[model samples]
Target: MTTAKTPAAASPDTPQPHPRRWAGLAVLSASLLLVVMDMTVLNVALPQLSADLRPDSVQLLWMVDIYALVVSGLLVTASALADRFGRRLVLLLGFTVFGLASLAVLWANSPAEVIAVRAALGVGGAMIMPSTLSMIRHLFTDPRERATALGIWATMAAFGGALGPIVGGALLEAFSWHAAFLVNVPVMLLAIVAGLFLLPETRNPRPGRWDLPGTVLSIVGMVALVYAIKHFGKDGPTDPQTWVPALVAAVTLSWFARRNLRRPDPMLELRLFRGPAFTAGVVTALAVSIALAATMLLLTQWMQLVQGYGPLETGLRTLPEAVGAAIASPLAPALAHRIGARTVLAGGLALSGLGLLVIWSWPGTLDYWAVAIALGMVGVGLGSLAIASAVIMAGAPPEKSGSAAAIEETSYEIGGALGVAVLGSVAAAFYRTHLTSEELAAEGVTGRAAHVAQESIGGAMDLAHEMGGAGARLAAQAREAFTGSLEWTSVAGGLLMLAAALLVWRLTPKDLDLNEVEH
Candidate 1:
């Protein structure tokens, strides 16, 4: 446990590790957990939210997606502000907004109101997300201490994500879906109080003047890119609507990147990617997020709708993954010190991919054991995210920590957004293909019923229950179709993770040691 020694020497001007750094990490990790958990809580709450709000498909999609889309758009700007101001201040303000937005759900009777609340939460999330990383960089000056801190930080992030559905499901059982939103209030309030007293204030001493054009380009480009991905997922790649935004994103983002490169002090530190370890860390965060987002969405629905588990039961079943993540994440750093960072980081990705692949090719009839095994594997591999965070934060110079944090958080947001939209789109496409109108008609389901059945497994199941005697056939077919799509989605995510593992493997240094401090 104490293998890595403290820094051997330091000059008079060198900042010592914060006296309350461990306590400070708790506050930082708690805030980050709240933000990340919001990303996935809705996955479990969606059906209930949909039942109450009765949003049309597009409106329903936004209810689920707007939070991530908004956060992705604003993350860069928020990080820049944190660096310019004080990280503690930005974090405290974020807590207020987050609490207020969650409270706003009390009056959110309609889908539009709920969407508005989610968007506000997104703004708060963007502010809170990167500051945790930057603050951790600011807090622990010693490389070894920072590595251990990052392990705990990654643990909370991954655990919160895996635990969201469980918490949401439990909340849904005892209260309305609104409870899912309301639960954030007390935690945020406590965090604000703790942050005020315990957290240290830190910011860039020489943050240059803000770049308005770069800011505008980032918001526009990032929002457009997220929308295009969502559009592609919802409407397929062939649609001109999808490509229009894609083109706009490419143009604006290219300009934004060029602008960053040209400016002496860019809005984002695009230069961070020049470091191999940093690049690998960002890649790991993004790739893992994409797979995790898609898997959680598919699995939540599969368990609830196909297997007929209630929300709470479904949430409880998700615990295997969460348990695995909880166990693996914190231990990763010590493991990395032993075997090397590249092995833990890339190996984790590979193991996670293999886990997903196992699900894709479950032997004989699929059952709980198969899903459990795969989820545990994915969780253990996900533990490598601690290493990913350690590398990303460690690679940056202390002054540019905010930029490094922003890039890392941005990768997570964008990756999650794409995963839910793209891989989810692929799954939807497969479901519709497998559950065709012809097939519905053969099952004595035709007209609007056939249309509904072909639309989504959720719609099919709901309509089938309404059809009474004729429902059994329709329900069975829809479940099978959805299960098939889940398998396909899992395989796609598995392949993506495997590809990412190789890329990061190539990018990470062979002789790298995480215990060494980066100046």
Candidate 2:
């Protein structure tokens, strides 16, 4: 059983015993693992789910995007609730919800049911993430110790994200998509049991009552904004369905900001942005997320379509990237110490940009080893950014810790969605322009069928097989178009990363010791 020790009793100078510290690390890692695993686990399973459910486009989008949307929108509120209530209590409730939702997903036969369950899973994820970070904040009061703990935490998170596709591929081969959702059940249960036994209870001693209006406004604003972005990506900005929600979201968020300014106990204190380190960290998080998400989405398509790798093989090949990330994450803190956060962040971004450039310069002929090296560089850069950003956020005051963590997490979620939408659209546009008339004729795909196929890489693959000889030609052209698009996209990504490096170099402070800060 875990024993409650006062912060004074477990001072930074007088460290906790190795066993206790390691146990705490385990608890944090378990919570983070759940969060990271859920992020990408559904990707490989989406095809199977679509086949089983036969959802319409919108419903399918919801099935894929709702989890992230809900988690991103609710994170601030959930973190605040945890502070108001208790971290341990919130964690338990989250774990229970996640476990139950996993079961619901397994049992769900309808698209609507699956969407609802996925949304529930998002809520659980929102609750778990901030609490995990906050607990880490409390557990590792020493800067050196905290860095080590965070390294382990960051590695686990990266590993879990990479592991999702691999695990899903294995499950897909052996069983079905249902196995992917079901796998979470046993893991969640174990985490719950272990957390209850080993985790210490912590709470904000002076947390104010929950701000109902703030919560409502945040959720409504985020949902509206995300809906608008999704619609715009799918149908363009002039689409009434896209613009209306976006306009409404802007108005509501403005109102929310005004309301927060007036309230003494705001859900998220706007004052946190005054800190340059925190602000820089948030921007870095968002940019890194956009890069990672876009790269992964494109790389997966490239592997399966152009490279002709099966799902299992694609997953295995991607493991090198994860290994590189896992190795790099632990070195972040030391690098930061040697060169300062600003320098390290800038260098990391530059490395990422170079990696993307490598991909952009890749010849049409596929080279697995070269591709792997490029991807590994991208992973290393991201891993460094992830660890550094976490350290910045967790170093904030206890009262603001939850909100800070939420902001960082929100940046990632929104950035990821934006990346996919923007880069995916770019790819689609290229695919359309490059489609030869001969190719279309050969595939027996014309007009709407051809249009649909060009709109998405996945759709293209599906339509190609449906058509005959001509379809094969069309598919090859489409794949080549996608590769061309990826090359340009990578160039754009590299430029953005370089810009981020410059920004971080200018903005982040030097010699700031996170452990010395008061809650």
Candidate 3:
């Protein structure tokens, strides 16, 4: 009988620190930071963008969400493309497109034009993210060194996500919303130049041809699915418009998977899930992301609506979460080693659940310090999530690492969207059930006005401002209702995280060594 080769023995090259490695990391980090920052930077600029362009609500939603949608949709294909072509070449191309698209967005005069440019930016971002990680995999061949590198990469990603709102808010306060998009220009230019000089070309030795059909299928399926989910949450799941796209998405994705199962060189290798660690890691990552995404949305609203914080104040108040994550990033591997990844993940989830419970049980009187501490707990949980993802990718076969990374990212993007949609719907339903039309009318809301207010938490608050005494009463009621809903949501999130922890523990092998896996 033939013996299976081990990861360490299969591939003799183990990553060592080279002088140019840090430089390469710098380039990759900048690229990742830019892509992640773009994801949320426009949020602060949305009001300005709408005021300047006068877009409708749907258009506004598209502008806010389309970048993520497209990036998530195209990530699989982009990763495959990176493997087939050269990662460096792909990275540079993406940077160039992103820079040009940023300029286009800055100059856009109409909502349609802006949306178009944002979609283009998404395409560029998709190319950049997967390729950068794949390059990192090639550069850091040693599992331990790769883990360290991923920690830095993960830190940059988290920092960028945290800084986006603050940076965008500052830009908007000082200049215009256009500055938010335009800011990418210089960063992109610098990254492009640095990447060309410092980054090494990396590609698969036996890369398959670009699977165009699979690409189209994935894009259409993901876009349709996400759109359906968003519409379902905003409207109803039973709504024809919602179900129609969802049905189409399901069919297409199923077909895509079936096709991949038969193909020799599939765009995505479905067989990667044979490894229990990878499977458990993906599930843990997905569930944790869903909880975190939902928590972030609810917390933002709680700060602004309940605590009566301005945008800047809310941003500042949330800084502790980022700080906690930053402090924990470098320490993740150590913690993982000491406690084991399953235990660390379980503990992190437990901590996050406790944080959510704390917020849920907050007294009527606002306590900023308590809130900050809760947010910090969530941040620590997020750090664990990051570590889990790093472990998954590091544990994967090097040849299929790009696909593994793509799946990991896809889970996150999808989980985030699902969380916001599901939790937002729950909150909306509770808010409507708690508020009455009589109270709404007394607040200056009438006819379709009450209907619109019932549609969203923001709309409810806006309508409340119109109704004087009754509005004040209704606003208070709405706040209570929203908070109650959020409390339940937190419980659900906690349970989900707990379930994920158990799943990881059960599914992942106890003595599974990365050195034993096939490279």
Tens digits of per-residue lDDT, candidate 3, 1-519, equal 111122243244543434477678878988898787777676556656765787867887788668778887888888888888888888899999999999986568998899999999989988888787778787766565566667778777776777677677677777877888899999999998898888888777887777788889988998888888778777788899789999999998998999888888788877888878888878876887677676666766676677777556766777877887788776776677666666766677677767766766777744677678777887777666556666677566777778887887788788877777787677667677777777667766779987867655566676677666667766776777677777667767777777777787787777654323335
Number of clashes in model 3? Answer: 3
Q: On TM-score, who's better, 2 or 3? A: 2
Go through the candidates in order and give each one's C-alpha lDDT.
Answer: 0.88, 0.75, 0.75
Error of 2 at 100 (Å): 1.1
lDDT of 2 by residue, 406-495 (tens): 777788788887777776566656666777545665667778887667666667877877766646766777787887877777877778
The order of the candidates by TM-score, greatest first, is: 1, 2, 3
Q: How many clashes (backbone N, Cα, C below 3 Å) per candidate?
A: 0, 4, 3
The whole-model C-alpha lDDT of candidate 2 against the native structure comes to 0.75
Instruction: At residue 509, give the lDDT of candidate 2.
Output: 76
- lDDT string for model 1 (1-519, tens) is 432334465445557877788888889998888777777789899999999889988898888889878988999999999999898999898899999999999999998999999999998998898888899998888777889898989999988888888898899999999999999999999999999888999989989998999999999999999989988888878898799999999999999999999989888989888899999999999999898788778899999998889999988898888988988998899899899899899899999999998878997766777888998999888876678989998789888998899899889878988898888888988999989888888888889878878888889999888988878988998998898888999999999999999999899998888777558
Q: Residue 355's C-alpha lDDT in candidate 2?
A: 85
What TM-score, over all chains together, does every model reach?
0.97, 0.92, 0.91
lDDT of 2 at 244: 94
Stretches of candidate 3 exceeding 4 Å from the true structure: 1-19, 47-54, 365-367, 461-478, 513-518
Off by over 4 Å in 1: 1-13
Question: In terms of TM-score, how similar is model 1 to the real structure?
Answer: 0.97
